[model samples]
Target: MTKVRTINNYTGIDTRSAIGTVDHPLANMDHAPTISELCKVFLKDGVALAVNASRKALHEAQLSPLDITHVVSTTCTNSANPGFDHFVCKELGITQPVEKVLLHGIGCSGGLASLRTAANLALGSSFRKRRARALVIALEISSLLVRSELDSINDSQDTRIGVTLFSDCASAAILCNGFGGVEAEPVYELLGWDNRVIADTEHDLGFDVDPLGWKVVLSPRVPKLTSAAVSPTFNKLLQSLPKLPPHYKTASDFDWALHPGGATILSGVEKAMNITPEHMRASYDTYINHGNSSSATIFSVMDRLRQKDMDKLAPDGKAKDFVVGCAFGPGIVIEMCMLKRNMSHIQRTLVVESGEATPSHTESERSEGEAGQEIEIQIEMGSMEGKDEELGEKLRDMHPEVPQQGDSLSEALNGVELD
Candidate 1:
């Protein structure tokens, strides 16, 4: 137990969410749950979480369920017939005939891979002169597999660092084609993307299925191998997007939204890319607060980077307009993308508030008093709302038997260091 705690401290994760908490029936069992039992829990809690995340994304995008033309989902934790996306669509009232793609066998990079797939789908629709709004979802219920992993560790008497790294999360995003002709305000523009696999490292990282559940095959060399691949992968991405701002020449020039595979992974990538911790502030913050939630973690980091508070933590106290998104998966696959921040919406709002003449509005639409009142309302809303807490509550409600806060594994490693 002491050794495990020491190793877990190196992960730099303070806390993480899991499905089978300290009080869950599965946690109390003497052996791992059957495959059928795992499937039941996944269908219930996993699908519910996916639906909730998708609804939040659709709401924020101001799009209706019917507006989603395609669904691209990924998960390393569940492999049931019909997949969880099917139930997510049904629950969200998206009854329209929509194309759906579910990606499997992909580990941590699944989120970015799903986004790449959705981007291609959106581009295809544009080429056909058709409108498309693709919904991308990544959900992982890794906490449920704790018992199985523990059993394996005990049987082999070998360390499996993954047991201390993974958690549970569901994230969703809406991608639209520019040819849609809809007046949509996008937060980030996907300029370019690249995917590459490092040579001779096929066995270094993997997620293999077992009779009990899925087993994470993580080699200690993962951080070093992934770091070595970053420079070349990023160069290729930048080469493909030559139209980027002149000031953004290298990795350090732009902000980063990297998948927090682990503390070492983040630190290695930072060194390889010649960037600073401030460049990946959101990634560190997400990893420490939520741990690595498999395919769903990248979106959580992206969401954190866009928050107003993150601006203060940006390099030189000013956030960059461009961002680099990177993640690594089982095949030692590196998924990278270039994103340009869209601040037109915020700029336009500021212009209107200052009573300045703009192309869209010659006069102020709202009085100064009304504008101030609206700002106050938004501030109050932001302060009162906690997205993670709300989602945790919903999951706990769906599975009342599982305690949401305390993790059984963490309890076992009673002396684990937490930030």
Candidate 2:
């Protein structure tokens, strides 16, 4: 479980420098391409960006295209026919029969969802035979969705607020299990992941697709609804960890990559999760500089974390350092994951001295069986029924065209297989 590693990560640059101008990360698309034009430009440019980003990641990790066994990508911007995933594989010159998963519909949460799905693939037996290496990509072209027209005061407000923070972005990460990392730098291992759907919030966020293009929906009540739903779910996830004591929190060592859906959304998550603003500096910085490029935003934030030096996540006595990723999207979905950094030489020495295989969660304690800690999360959600033209188009729900690679930790630990 500890071997799963983020070998390298990269973010795409907007070819259309005019997109993110002085004020907004994504300038108004009033003079931008039409739906058909945007689709063509976006896919072409997005694919190139993704491929180059992947190349950069592989280069930095000193890996080759032959090292990658699978390709996974997620996006809500535009759904293509062959899917740009094929392009990624083709560009990387990966001729082997690599597994591929291209997810759509899910918005901001799709990044973490993609990583989680890749983690499952890495852990599964089918893909774990020799080694597991997967590339995860997220791209968003909000400028294409930017609109000057509005149908209602709601639409006007949404576009106005949306344009202020939305941008064009693409990010790629290489994840491998066991033999993933050879460098001594700190490693981010996927520990666990959980997701929750806030009932009745479909309209809170989504793309209103038509023959013209897509329009973003930004409900004003998002903060209240999101906070109410996220509070308990966040708590529920913490309590689900194995070694973690139920209802125990002291000094926080978790490096959070909370999706910056917006400024208010950040505050809402903090209020709901009881994490201070300091924990979300990465998210805020991304928002201010890159805007909410949908699913790709989290990676930019993680890049900031990496730049600031991730060694802090290494163990320091009882001060545990962790990486937590969170994102919310259409369907009122909340995706989250907890990742622990690979032990540095010092940390390995300390753990060996303590005779523990993993970090201990002895900072706090709670009752073993404290009745039921269930807390219902409520929010206004509504699926866009008629807007099916977007997702329901050529790419419907298509599961990965491969068998399971490995099992979850509960089913069978990949410890031996990975090592």
Candidate 3:
């Protein structure tokens, strides 16, 4: 039998740029009260960003809480007993079944792993037995794991690459057996999945669970490893297919939705798979603005594509085929999915605003940061749905001791107790 589809997705980001940064470090932390306080500042930010994303999906798709059947949450950053999966159910007023999966110590690629799991569940389960719907949320707080004291950040060598390159983010995606209210035309069919774990690379990229939090020890050889495996795996995937599309030249030929592992990782993949500049820009820009929010990073890029008005950009009805998404993790494994783009008017304009107005962030709040220190966080929340002060109040009330204006959000979050 044909399986259900992943219909809609939403992304979110929380960083100094979006939320006011403070010198204390803890100020910019995620405001949700359930998680450990020892978490890296970025984790909280990432979750907040992800929350907005889930909200956006519910609002934009006009999906009611009762319509949702399952909630699958993915994260490698932080996990509390009553995790965000439950928070999502509670906050969204979704009384449906919620399953929270912490892909802890797994690394960045876990998002795809979770997606595959969700897809399989939807495919395997009996839709007739019960309404089958699943929502997957991937939130990465890489910022929380950065060790400023580590030689990587302290030393100017390749070690510092990890701390400086990683940012914080969160993303929420909804997958269901039916499209609910919208026309029944499915977006992406559930094609077969192919995943491979490179052997003996466990030490290459893993986390150190210490008193501070999850510290990433990513090997410099990561990009090379990624470059080495991508082509063969891709070719092997193509071989399995009965007929290959002539349009497929390289990994870049299709729309690339790869995890923004880092700028260098992207460059390596670009060289390895012949990815074009346009294809890589989304990943790179997401990393630059929001850093790496783990699973959420890819969705952020997708959301940007959605926001860029791809339809207006390609109005000739020349739809793209075989969109590929890849994510990497601890096993030095690559998880990839191939899907076809659905450029139907409803899908295209579903999230697009009626007016062609350029979205704006209120510039009047620029003075919120400290003197002489420029904030480097990405405020990729797109157009403001509510006032920054409203979010600021929520944050301040969550952490009353932290001053609103400071060097960075991390500094403010320094004092919060995760235990």
Candidate 4:
């Protein structure tokens, strides 16, 4: 117990959520729950969480259930026959004949992978001259695997720190093609993206299936390996975009929405990119508050970056307009995307009225404005709903205090170097 607490403290995660707390069925059990039991809990609580997230996203986009023409969902947790997205669609009263895509085996990068897939689908719809509104969802119920992981740790006496790092979450986003007549507000313009796998590092990270549930396989070298790949991938992503201001050449110039895989991973990336902690304020905040919720963590970080309080927390007391989104997964795969904040209508009008040079817009933006093609992306974190309200309320009640730099686990792992 002492060792577990110490390692968890090292990870800097204050709290995380599972299916149940006070009335947890497996709390008093002598052994880890069977796969059957875990599935039952996922079906009940997991589905509800995904539904809650989807509802919130739909409400925020000001669209009805029927407005969604395609559904793209990803998960490293559940493997049902019809998939959770089907149930989510049913619960949200989306009975239309919508195309559905369920992505598996993408791991933590699944969120961005799903977004990339949705963007392609939206583009295809645009080419076909049809309106398309694709809903992308990423959900994970990692907490249930805790007992199984503990059992592995106890039996093998292996220092598996993964048990202390994962939690549960569901996040959703709405992406609409410019062909539609609908006027939607976009938080970020999808400018360009890049995905690549580092060579000879397959054994470094994975999540394998187990009878009890699944087991996380993390190598100590992961932080070093993942960090080393960031620079090249980020450069490739930047090159894919149209000509931009010279100041955007480096990583620190833009804001970041990086998946907080762990304390070391975050620090390693910061060091490799030569970015300040303030550049990834939301990533660290999400890790400290929610831990790593697999594929869902990236969206949480992105959502946090948009909050008013986050602006006050920025280095200059205002958030940057250009942002970078990055995440890593099992294959040592790195996903990177360039995003520019969509100027609100009022902001655009003010710039025009003041006779100031307007900021550069992506091709998608110009299409939406001039060619009547609008591709709007809106990402949302799931809200507490149904039985999960108890967990949500508890989370809200807790205050998240950012620790000082000297108190961070990063210092301990700062010397980790790649082979």
True-structure lDDT of candidate 4: 0.73
Best by TM-score: 4
Alpha carbon deviation, residue 314, candidate 4 (Å): 1.6
lDDT of 4 by residue, 1-419 (tens): 34554556656677786656735766447888877787777777888888767766665565677777899999988887788888888877778799899999879999988888888888888787777778899989888788888888788876567777888888888887756455457766677789999888777788888888887766667888899999999988888875667778889889999998877777778899998667887787787678888898888888777765566556565678888999998888898887776535211111222422122221121123222333667764532223223323432333334344443233333322111
lDDT of each: 0.72, 0.56, 0.51, 0.73
Residue 235, candidate 4: how far off, in angstroms?
A: 0.3
lDDT of 3 at 8: 6
Error of 4 at 162 (Å): 1.2
Q: Which ten residues in a row have the lowest lDDT in candidate 4?
A: 345-354
| TM-score-better candidate, 1 vs 2 | 1
Off by over 4 Å in 2: 1-32, 126-130, 147-160, 179-186, 244-253, 309-320, 342-419
Question: Which regions in candidate 3 have their CA more than 4 angstroms from the true location?
Answer: 1-35, 39-47, 98-100, 126-130, 144-158, 179-190, 240-246, 249-252, 309-319, 345-419
Summarize candidate 3's per-residue lDDT along 297-415 as a digit string, tens digits: 66676555433333222213232555677777777788876655444413312243552212221111111211111100011224222232333333223212323333333221221
What TM-score would candidate 3 get against the native?
0.69
lDDT of 4 at 179: 64
